[model samples]
Target: MPERGATGPRVLLRRLREVMAQPASAQVRLDRIVKIIAADMVAEVCSIYLKRQPQVLELFATEGLNPDAVHKTTMRVGEGLIGDIAANAAALNLADAQASPKFAYKPETGEDPYQSLMGVPILRDGRVLGVLAVQNQTRRHYTDEEVEALETVAMVVAEMVTGDLIDPASLSGEEGRIGPRLVKGLALCDGVAIGTAVLHEPRVEVHSLIAEDPEAERMRLLRAVDELRASLEELFARAELGAMKGEHREILETYLMFAEDKGWLRRMTEAVEQGLTAEAAAERVHNETRARMLRQTDPYLRERLHDLDDLTNRLLRKLVGEETAAVYALPDDAVVIARAMGPAELLDYPRDKLAGVVLEDGSPTAHVTILARALDIPMVGRVGEMADLLRTGDPVIVDGEAGEIHLRPAPDVLEAFRAKTKLRAQRRAAFARARTLPPVTRDGVRIALNMNAGLPFDLPHLAETNADGIGLFRTELQYMIGSEMPRLNAQSAFYREVLDTAGDKPVVFRTLDLGGDKLLPYGRQLHEDNPALGWRAIRMALDRPALLRYQIRALLEAAGGRALWLMFPMVADVTEFDAARALVDHELGRLDRFGKPRPADLKVGAMLEVPSLAMRIRAMAGRADFISVGSNDLLQFYFAADRGNPRLAGRYERLSPAALGLLRHIVTEAEAAGIPVSLCGEMAGRPLEAMALVALGFRALSMPAAAIGPVKLMVRSLTIATAERFILDRLTSPAATIRRELEEFAFHEGVIV
Candidate 1:
């Protein structure tokens, strides 16, 4: 076999461009192109399979096989060796094509005689447009140079198919219109919204594929990379982002690392040297990287694909002299779509225009999801291949509550969602009207309804919901959102602002709940098999005394004669609480030593997230001022379920007999010890769950601001004694979940929940 080096592929590309430039029908052009690829690579067969639909790939042109099979042979996305390449968006080079498990016999194509095969996906903007493959009779592995040459040719072919050179309709059999479709995903936030799809970080088209001057393109590529790096540095230096330290900053740093990556630059430069424009080179390299990474099952590598795509798109825009930070002119009721994005990228869009967000890849704990919650935007994530199914400006109904996305929905479906949205609005209005009313039951039992908050955006809801106080002020958010560890003064200023915003309303400040999934950018991350159970929250704080001391100092400075309500998170035992409280004591002593004004009233509490803490509730009540049940973590721990895992979503019910019994035990112990206890996790925000907690003798509950009204309404309508009797009786029942029974009780009793 002859070595198809730099000159050979370039020579073939030059000839292919000549054929493409000629005035001919799409079929004639495709036929000639395949022949050129076969002759150049010294292969017995060459074929082009174009994606006509989402799942189906059709052979449009071929050489050295049954010529009659052109436009006749078809395969699904993952049916055969060709389909496997398309499905994974990666290249395949097989020594024995028939011996591969992925090989599927297609008698129509007469491909059985071919023993050696090499296939590469023709990718455009990270979407697999088609598969370009070559085969030979002899069983021999294709060399690296041969594979690179074929990939370069595939790049040229992608341009041809998408371009007017090959009429897409003639090749596929249908127009480009995508019909009505429904996609299911995980609900990251709650709400229903109807909107127009606005693709986030839209691809910059490469108008010029082949380079007129190789040296010029190389220089252009080098300049764009330098510009890309400088722009990222400038973004990092911005005052708003500079002081932030968390995953968002870490993501940007990763982006910068990709921008400056020597290997990434080398690959693009090599592509340019092989006869492609700077933009085309960047696109090709990214396509290859995306193909390789997409095949990886590792979540970390799959996630990095988004970062790589983002960087490549930025570089492409730079190469084309387009605005690197171009702001999109969003349509009314815009539903932003992306593979995945950092919080900062999501923030670039105007909040008012954004009706919701749909991600092909995202997690409930992702930073972008946190931001979406803060902005009060509905979000649905892990909706695979959404980009392929829907185009920009397509009508989209995001049913966040159901975790469903209806693309180009039917008129009736659209109307149904509109009605649902209106009904939701009406319910919210009703809740608002009754917001200021005290949450006192019909039997005159008073329940304290507080709001959980983290971001400054949440502070406004404190007044809106008429919450008694801030029950869980997640202080780690301030640390998470910045690019670097927030300085002492920055932390103090932020806490002070939060306190100022609340005014007279008490705020329970939960100290930095770092580590585990919520890792700090500057802090060292430990490799743990189960991060949730590993060193985090109180454990991490106790281990790093300075972290606790620094936050304690900030809270003290922020309080300055005001009341300070501090809480430690994930305290497994009484000893951890004692150690954490000692740091607080140390901070108070330091304030005294510095002659600084301390909080007028100080209250230190421990979150009962760990099941062990529940066992030691009596011991904890003796030392701690109050106990806030972190039901989200506590339930997961008790049930041995990972809350973040979608597979375990409904496996363990929150209203289960065992879960309620555990909560009842905690409340019983807390009441005996004379400590004011509250339930503050997601269970509190839910009306039905809140009803059950109230029955379990929890007088105080903290939830998202949106839940306050509904929970309050339930509280105002409840007969606590009746609910207690009903719930306690079912505690001994063998049901997997008591949700149905509770709902029945609520309905019969006229409980608003």
Candidate 2:
């Protein structure tokens, strides 16, 4: 064995590589890799344990830790340090392995010389493949350099074992080493892409249990109970303040009651009294609760698992003993995999490094999906809980566009993906070149193209894609991203940057449209039978003039002589429109008084989301400078179907008769009043929907950046006159027949509907 420090890291790495380069089978290569590691680190023992099928780790090769135990030894994840490392895909650098409580001594191995150990799990694309370790007799701590060196060697070892490089057939398990790569799963989002499987960001939240000093534990439980009650009180207060709907407040209050359940608290107190640490006690109680609740066959009861997980993680953070299981030094081009994530938490990651998102748990309405679409990251959700199957860095293939995930994908799969990726790049090049070619209709009617934006991060995309300007800038995102209410100055800074990005081009900014399914930091949600119809958007803003004024002032200050378009959401009545406009005027007056710079022409608009707004379109058009239809919310509220509820989801269709009638009404009224109107929502993004809107007398559309290309494709393919005629015919016909007519039109026009 080489003396430690006698050889530099490079020389050591070279030696290790030289050893692995020997002509040998996978097992031989693994053995030599371990041997080189032991020699370079001057360790008395070396071992490598690869993860077996399912969940067990089988001992593969070893130098000093019991050669006889090879293939005979096995450990379940969390059984020992090896087990823990395997389960968590984390490195273990213990100075005194023998003294550690987690160390599982094996008498049958007949090896006890090692007192210290350093193990680095072999990870490929965020999944654990195996562990590489070197143990020394002396109780010594491994340096950071040693850990890094070991990790690098492990990575090379993984490449060798997987045969991803060298022998392609070895990895592909077939001759020629290439074939069609196709894997399918449930679709979370509707799209197709060929991107590498990036694991979702790791989310490890732990809830703390109260201390077990009988009395102290009791007090701790009491404190948690009190905190739960206080949260409910705050929720109720917000509801009363008109910031939250009554139903949302009720849900929160119910959650608080569940948190204080006598039986649940009793279990937690028992764990604490049993002398477990706060975190452990909490975990135990959490496990018990999950087990108890999971047995229930009721869907509603089963859904409480999500709530429990959220509550437990929060409590674990309070305990302060919780450690994130995996520590990923993410690569710039890597994909992220996780069970699930909130919108704010997803932003913690470096956006550029992110390629796509793979989740074991996620729904269409999940906030993460909303952010993902805005970021243009290909994402798949509800991946059936694959987090446990993954390590910190396991090689994976995720095709967000195809709604597929491949674990340890074969070599042929990789090759086919690479080829498809090249083709996608070529297509993107075509799309980029086409962007400058103009979005004129076949008969020469030009269409405006704009991008939907939410955050400052989305600003750069304006230049990247063929977008005319910012269309719908969701203002609520600012409040949603922060822990508390963002100050007016902070809001102004963001708004100013956005307007400056747009330059002379118009940027439409939406006011705070938070409530119902969305959350507010300070306001209490009011109790109502149905939240969607309750306090939200313009309703909340009208009741909270301070919030409305603050946002208006920020927008005005940011415009600074630029052409600015501001819009409010859920305007149901002419009175509501008047009130909202009044608030905007009031804020402008204040901004003038404060000497804040203002736009030379700031146009205030109202989003025609509420059905009532659709009914009073003429009145609204008469009062407003411009109007933009928020179709996503409009359709939801129009049909009385909860947007997020999948059960009632299919009941309301965007292309349905009822929705089309309402849209036509708004368009006819807006045209008669000569108020320029545009649809700026998901409906505008759908090619057929865009066509229908244009045909139905709507002249402008605003959609997501990606949808711009497809919609423009439609625009270039059909004459505006033809589209207008078809739309009029469809609208004039009975509601029951519009869907078929639209489909036929889409087919005849080759619009790829």
Candidate 3:
């Protein structure tokens, strides 16, 4: 084998450009290109296998082998060396190609004489377009230089395959064009939205692949790196961000570190030296990194891929002189698609025009999910690798309620969703009519329907839904959104604004439920194996008394001369509640010492999230004012399942007899001891779940604002006595869940659930 030099790839790329410039059929150009690759690399065979679909690769063109195999040979992804390259989006080099376990021989290809083979994936925007390979008869290893040269050539090949040179329609199979596809994911926010898909951060197309001046391209790459670094540094230098302390700060620091990474710079600089434009260098390097990271099983390492992708995108845009603007000329009804994004990024869109959001990766507890909930936008998450499957203007239906995404739906499917949307609008109007009605059932049992809130944005919904009060005020959101810890006055002012907006309506303030998934930007970072069960909520508060005291003082000051309702979350036993209550008492004492005004009335409660708390509820009632069943956490803890894990999402049934039994026990115990009990969790937001809870003796339900009206209508139509009797009969049943039964009952009884 001859020594492969640095200029070999450049020379090949120059010839390929000449072929692409000539007016010829795609087939003719591809045929000539393969011949050039075979001669330049001095290989026995050179083949180009284009991805016909997600799972299959077809031989498109070849040289130095049987021409009969050009359009006939095919292999499933991961079936052979070519397939392996496509599946993993990585290169393969072999001294003896036939010895590898992944080798798949095709008689038509007539390549049994080949001994060594080297292949590289033709990648664009982190997606595998095809595989480019060279085979040699002699048993020999491909050098690193040879591998780099092949990868560089493959990059140029990707441009040709995806560009006007090769029509995707011609390469595609009998499907003609991509058709309607339904993808399932997790519901982050519940609603339904019909819109066109729009990528949150669209990839900037690099038109100039080959560099006219390598030195100029190298300088351009360096300049973009410096600008990227300066921008991130300026962000960190802002007053609020400068004082940031914990997880959020750490994330930004990581972003900055990546922007200044020497290894990343070296890779892109080398790509430029290999004769690619600055933008192309960034694109190539990012594509390579993303492909390698996508195959990693380590979640932490895989997650960092998003950071790398974002940084590289910024650099690419800079190189192309594109402005870093958040706004886009989006369609009137646009659904944003992203791998993952922050709350601020979501807020950048024109909310009125933005209909929904779909994330390839996201969780219910993610800040963006919370923002989506507050803004009343439909959002579905964990839709794997959607960016590659979807186009910018494709019609999409975000069925967030069902956690389904319908991409380019057939006419009938689209019409059905349109009808569903119409019906949903009608239901909303009905809910609005029942907004001011009392939540009194036909059996004369009065239930309290309250809204759960956190941000000030949720305040208007209190009036819109006409909720009885704010049942669960998640205080952690204020801390989560800011870069630095909110000072006493700022916290106090925000709380005051909430109270003022509520007017006479009671608000239950749950003290900073910080740790766990709701970690603060300014708090100490904790790495926990099982964060849900680790030091969180009341546990973190008690351990850090000053943090609790600061928040308590703010709440106290904010509620001066008004009634104050506060709760301690994740209380395991009476002792924990007692300790947390003691902090509130201390804050009241401090107010008195400073001659400051105090709340006219104070009610301290325990949030029943831990299972052990149920056993101690009787004692808890004696000391606490009320008990709010944190059903979301309690049910997960009872079932010993992580709520965030998608695999376990359907494994545990929240409507199971055991779950209701436990909740029934808590309500019974709390009632016997003369303490008011309410449920404030995701379960309360669903009409069916709320109906079951009512049957189990829960009278107070706090849910998302959108749910109050529907739950209210259900309550007004239900007869508690009949519901109780029906539910009691099933409490001892062997059924895994009573969901179907409940739905049937609601339908027959006209319960509006």
Candidate 4:
């Protein structure tokens, strides 16, 4: 697109490299770089704004603007054009700056006459380090090519912004010292843990961007690409993946298409040929592609960028000769910090060593957080740019209850955390002594405290929690973790281990509840605008009857004369429950015909997750074995909110009147049928919520391992009749929510929070 011997991103990078290599001050290099960018982009103005912390960006260098504006103009992210680019981590191009709606007049910059503006985020890894901008006096539109080129240059210069070259001089105060930083985030799981930060996907540091020998770098790039292609081919050819052809096949082929893309290969080769190292070349193209993709308004397209980013991570590691195995060798007291992670990635870390997990990007319902809760590992998420703020082995404290982290905290802070932890430990110790004691309330009401488990890792905690039984063993996790369709034998073996671990203790396995967000690795994900309400759980299992039969058969075979308590999830109606139960009956008959061992006792139940199921409980009374209220899904649906969305987290409460009425209906229906009902999910994990559930006549409570002690303590303190009377009295109110009154009651009763 440029004339021969003229400039573009590559040329600008080359010139910037020369300037960086020069023996000059940081100020001079910044001044020269701005001038060079202005000249290269053929713009009248160029400026650099570096982020000093989480909130603000300061003008560091500029050319063709008011000289006084340099180091004087400051704006918080989202304050101006530069701020918008920084806030969104995207490029903002305008043909007319004054005409733009987001335009903010900066008198100090003295650029009121400029009509055109284009700014791109300077990024390192996934974090926005600063912003680079160019403006023109005449009305102008920046082409996609120009935006891409500038973003590429910005990537190359992001390291300089973060490094010592500008550090000591860039900061204006003592707090600017690059030491430890504290940040707050949303709590995903409950507990407290102090540990060292372990980056899940540690950056593959590329020291040399500009190569001494371009041809050699080109050859290196070619070899890496070839190896990468071969690796993908081998993955496709794997014997285990043979049956995965139609299911997970499209994913591999899509990856193959990217691996074999001519344009992608050319970009790498061209970058290498133009004096960049193989890793650097790949990084350049990857950054350029990401910068473009992440800026889009469409979420689906933005999500697709992760595939390319992952591929780049893999390629960079291969180019640098780094082994993936070594990257995951977790240290003691490890608190994993990741930009994001899949369920499998979270499972790979040893639970014994993994004290906590901190996600820069994640939701409450993410399986990683779910599993962390099961393991009693503290977790916090949505801490933006956490990886950039934390270094591996940096001392950090994860306060999941408060949803805060202290990086290299002061001694007094450490002592305070230790004291708090000790008090919790002492309380847990007291509860531990009563582990063998009956879970009976003060007025002699028996409570069935249980644990929610999914994996073999959860088995050990059962004894520790002193649970009466496993209330919800999510069978979907095994299928979710696998790469392909697991055969009947494999399914049976996994279920057998879960049964064996439970021994004499009762275990209620929730049949495969995959779909919605809990998608299988080897299954086609349905396209749905509102996934939570779409085809999932019993809906999916019933559509494919064979799949449901196989799991039922496995459960029967694995029980080996022991009683089997299995439940169906997301039962929209009594008919769905009947249909699901019919599958189990068919499996039982087929197993009987084949002389296969069946459960000595079989109890079928429906998960009361949908409000429709609660309404139809009168019809399901004699038909259903028992009912378990899935409080997580129930609350979200009752309030018409998505549980995965952080914004809606505080919108509803477990003790809301609607929730109380819905739950009361289930309890009343179950009582009329003389069948037991349980309340499980995140709500049961909190002591106050657990107390409210107990008050609502939910005798069985299944929760994360860490919650058992506190909940049991709450149960021991309450008289059920008194709690019921109090709750019923409060429920008479027409108010939408009763959480405030419930909290007051818990306080009056001295329930531990």
Candidate 5:
């Protein structure tokens, strides 16, 4: 206890208030707080620790023992005396602390003559931010008044650290520029992504520290462990009946095992025994484990890294006391920068809040990348070694499709990026405006434009793009997102919504096309050297009658007397198409007999995506009502190029004479058979390709919502007769530079600049 002449509580508070009022930094305020506390308590040392980041308590200011160590040291959530207080969300006061059972000594901190110690957690909203402590050489017990006074001081310090003492300079600027600029490693996902950088969303950092009381610490750990077990139970319970496959559930079970690992819990207890906070201990272990795993060469072990990272993040939150939302805070329109992102994690993020994604590690074939493409967010990936170079609030630019990034760009660079953004917006706007106009050449040749929809939001494109109707609605995406195999009623609801949205326009719904690269949420795996050639589309459907029958029934129920146009994807030959058509007929006949509702008029079609289908198109033309070319996959197969393989990407050209010849053949056969031919793929989204389709006598072209405007503009500028002649003339020519040739054609035709 201090002597009667020592600084009064009122005086100490006033001085702290004064120090905090100044425009000085955290370091300065912290120093002043430590000095006042030491003087008032007549202690040999006074220290303040602040939560600088997740599970990280940094030593900000101190007096007495090793002043040099102050601001130069950091501990995990549950490190030493200070960490323990913060971790447990409690206070500690002891005379002769060195002799206490819970005492932890640090060699780097050097020796201290202190015989007494008092510590308190700096808390906000019942959450621990850090700790404040004072030590005295005299062997003496701290009084209740002394503890109260110290707690009051801690409150003041917490306020300062938490930005309760805000300076204009402290706040992040409107443009995300503040403090000393920092560069960080960013994870990229998509190859072409461009958007404004924004702050990461906040997630729970730390939870609670190990209690000083052995029994109490044990109870806390056990409770957290139980909660973890419950989490796993719920996950498993949901998975049992959910849409996800057994393998996904297996991954979840593995995560549960990692959480319950005996070694992990033992380390937590050890930290508590050492008087380190629980959060600190867990974080230390997690970081060490991460470091070790990073060095491992095994692929299986490396994948386990994600499991560990997730479990550690969860355990650390429980220990240090933080929520998952604290990990990032994003604006409505912002780009995400991260080391990497799992597909599940990406689902939690708001689509509107996400403008683009920049990743440090990701490939174009990654699931998250596919999702990014689906969302139409520009993304750039594989910019390794960015996390260390960039800070949380630093400016970043990502070009998703192009795979480019600019950090702390110069004025000219910023202007150029902004200009590029404006041009893209302008182009999109132009496309939307053209949607109202018919997809016809300036000479007045009519062409049918449609949209390829997967989600409900995609329905609006039918109206916005002035598309004739949905040429292809991928029915499997709904199943991919759900937890269970969606009931027939649920599928009916969505199908009805799409049809109603289209009104009188034709809406072609594709059956559940799962297999190959497209993974099913439910556990069903058959490893093959080439999945693309293996079971998929009609092949998988033919085997899984239950899956195919369900979709057919849903379509029939949803049609509700309306005209329903349906198609089967990846039909290899006329026989597959015939078999698929027979199945649909069987379903229709069964529904009629059972008095189940179905469309009064249904048009059945098949996608000419496979090369075999194209070869047998003449036979298929008479058997099928309509034929739509799935050009994206068709071109890949035609050239023997794996479209998703980055190494082989850009190796094959869609405009190559061979691919074009096949397309011409399909169109001619379809025309001769008097069947309407359309294209639903990425190629149709391009302006020049839209023109090519027009020349090839494809009256219908279906694309994504965003591409409608651009393609419309190209259609409006084209002269169908001239385009056909120009393309045919080049078809026989020996062209080494096809892209250049196409560009020259576009320039000559005045379809694009």
Candidate 6:
């Protein structure tokens, strides 16, 4: 056996090349590779375990211990030390093998003589294909250098496994696919929904592995790399992606760095030099890198692998001359499953057919996840290996509330869930009975419970909830839902229907809040580093007056002698608000001069989202006819926390002293100036959050139609005067948790929660 540095990597590579130069059989080459590794490491035993099936790993070759055990000794994932390494995508190193808790004895292997052990997972794109391990006679700890060297060797083997060099069927005894598996994930939205699987991003199968011309293949690889760079540049050049300036842009930047890494390119170039096509070489490198990252213990590193995986796919598409994959015709009640996706891609699906969404990778605060919540779709994210586990139209139940998935569930289990689902429907029906009840407090303080409407379809929900009015009429949804930007007449007709449906109830229209995640497909593409705080909302509208002008003109036309309340979103300062209002005044003058019917009563307002507006709340109050707090964006901007990241979701509590202090300041300023202030964000939808708002001097709240009943019930059961007192008392207590304290007060005061 070679000792210490007696056999370096160059020597091992030469020996491996010498062995392969003979043009032996696949089995012979695989066996020889393990033997050389054992000799180089001076190990008593070295073995290779390939995934014979998704759940089964078989000992394909061995240099010592027992050759008879090859292809015979097998372990299901999570069964033993080797299985654990494959299951968790993590390497295992131990001085004593049998004494370890995960140790499992195999009678056929005869590995009792070996004490120390090291095992590294062979992976491709976060999927484990096999495990490589070495054992020694004496107890010893493997160094970092040893692990890295062995991992490099494992990468070579991974390429062979994924390519035509090795037949997957020959290695696996299982005929085809595995069935009925549970995939864990991060729960994004709360609900339970049963539906058929609909894959958002279908896998692209690569047929060619070896190249006919090495030089041509290298050139092909280079061209694909250039095209990939162009595509990324085009993505950054978009005005629509302005919201992605920080973390989102950083992801692509890191990917570009990896794409340009000389080590990565050298590996692919060397593979091409060794008679593989550019596609084949890149695939091998991608799979090897993916497998290694999947095994990493660091969540951040593991998460970053998703980007590399995405970039690899993009390069392959360029090489294949394929445009972006398209959404298939969805089945009724389809549960959309994706690895990860942008918000625009999620919106492309037909909303009625889409029942739920399950993702292999996504954070709770991701933009698409927020859209899922708004659309009332049950969602679960970070579901590992979801694509491998199920096919299209497979029966699945996505339990977003519990963060569980039931695939091909047993009849008994289905029946149990059916009953649970029915009971939930009954509870919702009971809540609907409160629609006719007045939103007056126990002490007769009048509270306004308004519903927020988006699409034209949302009008029926307003009647169902008997909301006070449409507190926020999101006009952007109309643009988003359309295949192209609707004509000005089309926009006017839609607005007319929305107001007509409300019938005497007031409706506040938030003018086209596009840019960032709300971008229309037909509008000009935006390239922004961070659209959320950048040129979005009022900024986009002000810069592009034609777009804002047309929208306001439509609103004026729709109102036609009735009152028209228009709100400008993402107003940074009082001056921005005045400028937007000036546009509206200009439209009014044009209508008057042209002898056309205009809005009989025009009410202008601003969305309090940016901190600058809050700081100058008094100035805003003096100019604006009304003010509505967009709690979602306001809180998001206030903490400088990306609302799309699940890790930072609970970074700051809504009812915290700091948050309350900000709300109190806004409320005080608005009330002193005699302007009505309402909260129209996700925060107002929850009963607890709405209670907090009422205590902080907010008289009006707007949320989704379903939330109105719960929020209204809380309002009817509590006294604002008492809530105000509770607020004053807690203001002085630094440790006060309004969420808990208010809930306790509500309970004792006979308020419904």
lDDT of 5 by residue, 97-130 (tens): 8887666776556546788889987764235667
Candidate 4 per-residue lDDT over residues 199-223, each given as its tens digit: 7777788877777777888888888
What C-alpha lDDT, on a 0 to 100 scale, does residue 402 get in candidate 2? 57
lDDT tens readout by residue for model 1, 327-348: 7577868998888776546756
Residue range 1-753, candidate 6, lDDT tens digits: 234475655466556656655677767888999999988888888898988676888998898868899889999999999999888877788989889988989989999888999998886555677899999989998887677567656656675556534445444332333666666677788778888888776655555655667899999988888887776766655664555443344434555565666787788777676556688677767776776765543333454565566667777878877655444567888888788765545555677888899987776535566557656789998776676567888889898866788887777877877887897687577677777889988888888989987765468777778889999998886676444788999899989988898889999999988777665645666677887777788998999999899999999989989998989999998889999999999999988998889877889999998878888777765579999999999988898888668588676578877788888889998888788899999779888888878888899999977688788878888888888888777866676356788778888988777
Residue 392 error for model 6, in Å? Answer: 12
Q: Residue 353 error for model 4, in Å? A: 12
Residue lDDT tens for model 2, 1-753: 234776745566566556666787778777777777787788888888776643667788898887889888888767788887776666799988888899887765655877888997765433566778888878888887678667656655655655422332222223331323333454554444434444443344332212325466557656765665564455346533235332233344445555666786676665555444445456555644554554443333444454565556545544453423223456765667765554433554666776667776665434456556655677776665465455545566667655787766678877887787886677567677778778887887877888998866567778877688887998886776444788988888888888878777788998988877666535554566776778888888888888888888888887776777898888888898898888888877877798876678878888888777777777665579999988888888778887656588576777776677788888888888878888888778887888887777676788877778778777788777877766666555555436677888778877655
Q: How far is candidate 1 from the true structure (C-alpha RMSD, Å)?
A: 6.9
Model 3 lDDT tens row, 70-112: 7789999899899999998988999999999989999889998
Q: 3 or 5, which is superior by TM-score?
A: 3
Runs in model 5 deviating more than 4 A are 1-318, 321-334, 340-356, 360-395, 401-403, 407-415
lDDT of each: 0.85, 0.68, 0.85, 0.79, 0.69, 0.78
lDDT of 4 at 482: 47
Cα RMSD (angstroms) for every candidate in the order listed: 6.9, 18.4, 8.0, 8.2, 15.1, 13.8
Off by over 4 Å in 1: 1-182, 195-207, 215-274, 285-356, 363-377, 390-395, 407-416, 522-526
Which candidate model has the greater TM-score, 4 or 6? 4
Clashing pairs in 3: none
TM-score of each: 0.72, 0.56, 0.69, 0.68, 0.61, 0.57
